[model samples]
Target: MPRARVSLLSLGSVRQGLRDSIRHLQSSSARASSTSPNEVEHSDFATEVEINDLPDGSAASERIAKAIGCSVNDLNAYFDPADPSTLSITAKSLKASPQMRTSLLEWRQNIPPISLRTERAKKAYRRPIGLNAAFEKALKVLTVDKHEKYERILRLTDKVEGIINQFNVKAIDEIPVQKKRSEAYLTAGLIRKLRIDAEINFPEVTSQFEMGKFDMRLPVYQHLVRARWEKNDRLLLIDRMESMHVIPDTLPTLYPQVDVKVRFPGTNTFWIDPGRVMSTGVTASEPKFSIQMFEDSTKLFTIVIVDPDTPDLLTDSYKTTLHYILSDISISGNSPLVDKANANELVSYLPPHPEKNSGYHRYAVWVFEQPNCEPLSTEKLASFDLQNRDSFDIRRFSQLYGLKAVGAHFWRNKYDSRTESVREKYGLPQGLVYSHKRYQHYEDYAWALPDLEVGDENKA
Candidate 1:
C-alpha cells in the first residue's frame, strides 16, 4: 500500500509500515553494490590491471582479463614501448594517426563550432540580461522579504509592549519596597540656608524657582557655577515703577574728554594718554572721540597728551602740541576771542539745562582740505551765547585748530550753577555752543575751576 494509505490505518500499523520502507531501501542499495560488476566499477571506462600484478592463467587473472575488453597479451602492449610486436595508445601516438585526425576534424565540424561560438557570445551577452532580470526578481523577492520583516517587527513591538506592561505591573508592586529614605542630616534649616544663599546671589530668581532635588554628584562645583532651578530665562521680581531711582543721564552723541595738559604754560592741563587707563575695571562711559575733515583748508594740528607712564599716573602735568595750519596773519582777522577762548565753546552751543551738559568736554580736532564741505554747520550747538561774537573770529580759530569745529561734551563734573562760576559770570548758555574761547590752549586759560585742585597746578 502507498504511504498515504498506510497513514489511514491504525497507529501501530503505520509505524511498522514506515520501518519496513526504510529497511527495504537500505538492503536494495547494499545488494546492488555487492553483486553487480559494472555498478562496482570506479570509472566509466573498463577496469584494467598491470601485467606485473597478474598471476599466470589463474582464476583471478582470468577474471581481471575478462573484466577488460582485451586479452592478457593486449594488456602487455601497454607496458612494452620498443617491442615490434606491441601495440600501444598514447596522446602523441593518437595524434599521429590519420584516421583519428580525420575523425577528430570531422567530429569538430559536425559539432558546428561557429554555432558553439555564437552560442558562447549569446551566453556572454545574455549574462547581463539574465543578471538584470535576476536582479529585478531579487528586488521583488527583497520587497516581499521586507514586508515579512516589517510584519515580524510589528509582532516584536507588540511583544515588547506586552513585556513592558508586565514589567510596569511588577514595578508598581515593588515600588514601596524600593522607596529610598531621606538623608538623616537633611533638615529645614539647611534648606533655608541654601535658599538664602541662592537668594543673595540671584535676587531676581525666587525660592520656588530655586527649589530642586540636589544632585549629589555635582556638590563640589555647586557654588562656582551660577545656576538656578527656574526654567524661565528672565525674571523681574520687582516692578519697574518701584525700582525707579534717578540715574545720571547720558549726554547723547558727544564724547567727554578731560584735558590734563596743553601746549601753553601757567595753567595746569593734565592729558591722559589714550593708551593708559586708571584701571582695567574702569571703562569709558562716554562715546569714543574721532576726527573728521573740513575741506576748506590744509592745517596740521594734533592733541598730544602726557604719557601716563612718565609720571606713573595722570595727576602730573602733561605736554601737548598744536601745529598751526596757516602762517599769514592777513588771512586771520584781529579778534580777542581767538586768543582768549578754548575749543569747547567754538564747537558746540551750551544747553539751556546746564546740568544736562555737565562733565568733561572732549575737543576732537581734525584736518581737512576745502573748496568747501557742506558749510561748517552746528547741529548740537543750540545754546550758543553770541551777544558780542564775530563770525570771522570764530571761523579763524576753527581754521587754526584744523578741525571743522570742536566737538565738546563734559563728563568730569556735573554742571551746577554754583560750582561752575564761569558759566554764571560769563552768561554762558546752558547747551552746546560754537564759541571762540572754548578752544584756547589750556595753559593760556584756566581749563577747570579751582575746586579741581590737581596737585601739579603749581608746576604748570
Candidate 2:
C-alpha cells in the first residue's frame, strides 16, 4: 500500500508499516552494495534487483554483458555505484550501438542538476555587488585579514543595509526580537569613525539615499574606514545627524577658524570636542572656550555665536540665528571675555535650551577679525536686531564691515528638565518647543534677548 493509505490504518498498524518501509529501504541498499561477482553465481536475487534498477533494465545489462564477454549475472554483480568502471563499460557497449547512445545522452542531458532540485533562499537586503578590485585582493590575504585591517573601507558607495530588521534588533531576547533604531544609528556612526582612504562626493546627491541601501555588516564598516581617513571626520562626525549630510566638514564654506578649546565649568569638569553632548543644566551650562587673540587688546573684534539648527532641523527656515554677538569687544593676549570692565556687552551669552520635544541643536561660534583702526561707521552696517532678527548671514556681515572669520567651532545641545532653572535665568518666555509633531522649533526668544538696544559707539 502507498504511504498515504498506511497512515489511515490503526495507530499500531501505522507504526508497524513505517518500520517495515524503513527496513525494506535499508536491506535493499545493503544487499545491493554487498553483492560480488563470485557469490552471485550461487544466488540470482541480488543480480535480479541490480538489473531491474538499471535505466535500460535487463536489456542494457545483457548488452553490457555481451560486450564485456561476461555472463549477465556476473555483469550485474560486478557493477558498483562508487566505481566508474562499470558505467564506462556500459557506455562502451551503448556507443557500439549508435541508436542506444543517442537515447542515453539525451536522457542524461535532460536530467536536472542536483543544485537545481532545491528551492533558492534569498536574503532580505542585497548588498551592492562587485568590490573595489584592489580592496578585494587586499582582503583575501591571510595576514591582512587576521589583523582586521582590510575590513575598514569608506567608498562613497550608494548602498547600506539591515539597519531596520523590524523590531528584531534585540541585543538580548527570545523569539520575535525587533532591532532598535539605534543599531542603525550606531552602525552609520561607526562608519564615520573608521579609517579608510576614499574621496567624499560634495556634489548634491541626486539618486537614492546611501544609508538604507544594503546590510549594515559590510557597508557600515566601509564607511567607518573611510571616515577615519578623512582629516577631521573623527573630530566633527559626532552623531548620526552629521554623517547623513556632512556640510559641517566642508571648510571652504566656513574657513580659517580660531582654535576653540572648550571646557565645561560645572562639576563634571569635562572638556568639549565636536559632537560631544553635555547634560541640559549641569554640564550643558554655558560652556567657556578660551582663544588666544594675537591681536592687540585695544583692537576691536566681533564674536558671534549662532545656531544653524533653528526652527526645527528638517526645515532650516532660520539658517543662522544670531544667538550671542559681541561687537567692539576687547581682545588681548589673554582671553577677551575674561574681564567685564574692558569688554563691551552688545549681546550677553545665553545657555542652549533644546526644549523637551526638540532634538539636538548645534550651538556654533564664529569669531570675526574687525577692521584695523579705521573709521567705525554704523551707517553701512546692516540693521541687525538681537530680538527680532530673521535668517542672519555671516559672510554678508563680514564683507560689509571688512571683517574676516578668525576662529569657529560648535558643540551639540539637547533638552532636559535640569535646564528649567537655566531657561528661567535666560528669561525664556515662548520656549524652544514651538511644535511637537513636525519637531519643535526655536522661537525668537531662544535666539535673542526680548528687547536689545543697538549702540553705534566706536570705541576704536
Candidate 3:
C-alpha cells in the first residue's frame, strides 16, 4: 500500500474525523448485533495506548492512516464539499473493516477530548492578540527576571551554607575556648564580607540570605541580626531613651553597644517593647533578661534597675531608688541569657509600685561592663542596703566600681489596681494620697479688706 499522503489540515480536523468514524462503527456494530443472533461478537480491542503517546503528532497520524488503508490527504478531503455518496461509501468501508475500527478506537482513546485539556495548556497553545500579546510578553519578561533573582539568591545562600558548614563540623561547646573565639571572629569577618556584597549588589534581595538554618553563634545569622538591630531597633531605643529622659535621669548619658531585652516572667513571656507603660501587676515579679553581646570574648558585667522618680516626701522631689542589681554577670556573644545562679545579686529585685498620687515612674534597666572583669568586693556588696538603695546615685556608683555603661532599657510604671496589693506584698509603707494645697482668695483674706485698700496717692 502507498504511504498516506501528508495532509496540510490541522490536527483538530483529523481528531474530529476519527471521532465521527468511531461513533459510526459503534452504531453499525449495535445494528448488526440486533439483526443476527448467530453472529459471533468481536473481542474488544486489546492494543492500549496512553494519553501521553497522542502528541507524537505526524507519526501517529501516518500510522493511523496506514492501518485504515487510506491517506491523510484522502481523510482531509472527506470534510470538503464533495459528493455525498462518496463520503457514505467511505464511512461504510471504515465500519466494515475491523482493523480500521480498532485503529480509530485506539486513536480516540489516546487523544483526550478538547474539553479535557487544561486551561493552562490552552493558553500556552493559543496565540495572543493586541493588549493580550503585550501582557503575555510582559509576563514572560517578569518571569525571566524573577528566575534570575532566585538563582542569584540561591548562589549567595549556598556560599553562606558552605561557610557555616565549615565551622559547624564540631560542636561549639566542645571546641577549645581560645580556638573557638578566634574561629568565631574569622567567620564573622567572612560572613560580613558576603553580607556587604549582597547589600551592595542586590539590596532588595538581601533578606533572602536569612531564609535557611538560623544559628545565632554562626556569623551568617549574627551579622544579619546585627544589621537589623542597627537599622531599626537601635534607633528606636535611642529615641525612646532620649525623649523619655532615661538618658540624663538614670545615667549621665547612654551609648548602648549591646542589645538588652527584659521581660517580667509572670506577666509576659516575650520581651517587652522598650519604653512601654507597664502595670504594677505585670511588673511584680523579677524580670528575666537576654543581653546580646557583639563581642566574642566573655566579660563580667553589672545590671542595675533604678526608679528615678521614687517619691521623696521631705525633699518634695524625686530621687533615684535602686530596685535591682546584679554584678559579675559573665556575658558573651554566644551566651546571652542572664544566668542568675552565677551572678552576684547585689540587690534583690523590688517590683515597681508607684504610689497612688505619684506620677509615672521611669524604671531604668542599665547594663555596665565591669572594668578588668573584677568582681565587686564583699565590703561594697554588703554596703548596698535599703538605706543605700534609697536616694541612689548611679553615676557615683559607676565611677566607684569602674563600670562603663554598655546597654540600657527602661519602661514606665504608674499607680494601678494592683499597686496596693504589690505594696502590701513587699511589706512597704502605705502610700500617702497627696492633694494640691488650697490657697485663700484675695477678697476673703484679712489683709485684702476693702477698708484697708490703699488710696490713689499711695498707688502713685
Task: List model 2 lDDT by residue over 254-366, tens digit each.
Answer: 44433444566758665566656767675445556555442223445666776665663323444566667666655544343434454455666666766666677776666
Q: Which has the greatest TM-score?
A: 3
Q: List the candidate 2 regions with Cα displacement exceeding 4 Å.
A: 1-252, 268-270, 283-286, 293-299, 312-319, 332-340, 373-376, 380-382, 430-460
User: TM-scores across all candidates?
Assistant: 0.16, 0.37, 0.53
The TM-score of candidate 3 is: 0.53
User: Per-residue lDDT of 331-438 in model 3, one digit per residue for the tens?
Assistant: 877889999999988788888988777788999999988866678776765554534678988888887777888898998999999999999998987776655653
RMSD of 1: 37.5
Distance (Å) between predicted and true CA of 65, model 2? Answer: 99
Q: lDDT, candidate 2, residue 111?
A: 26
**lDDT of candidate 1?**
0.28
Clashing pairs in 3: none
Each prediction's number of clashing residue pairs: 42, 22, 0
lDDT of 1 by residue, 311-337 (tens): 111233321212112111111111211
Instruction: Return whichever of 2 and 3 wins on TM-score.
Output: 3
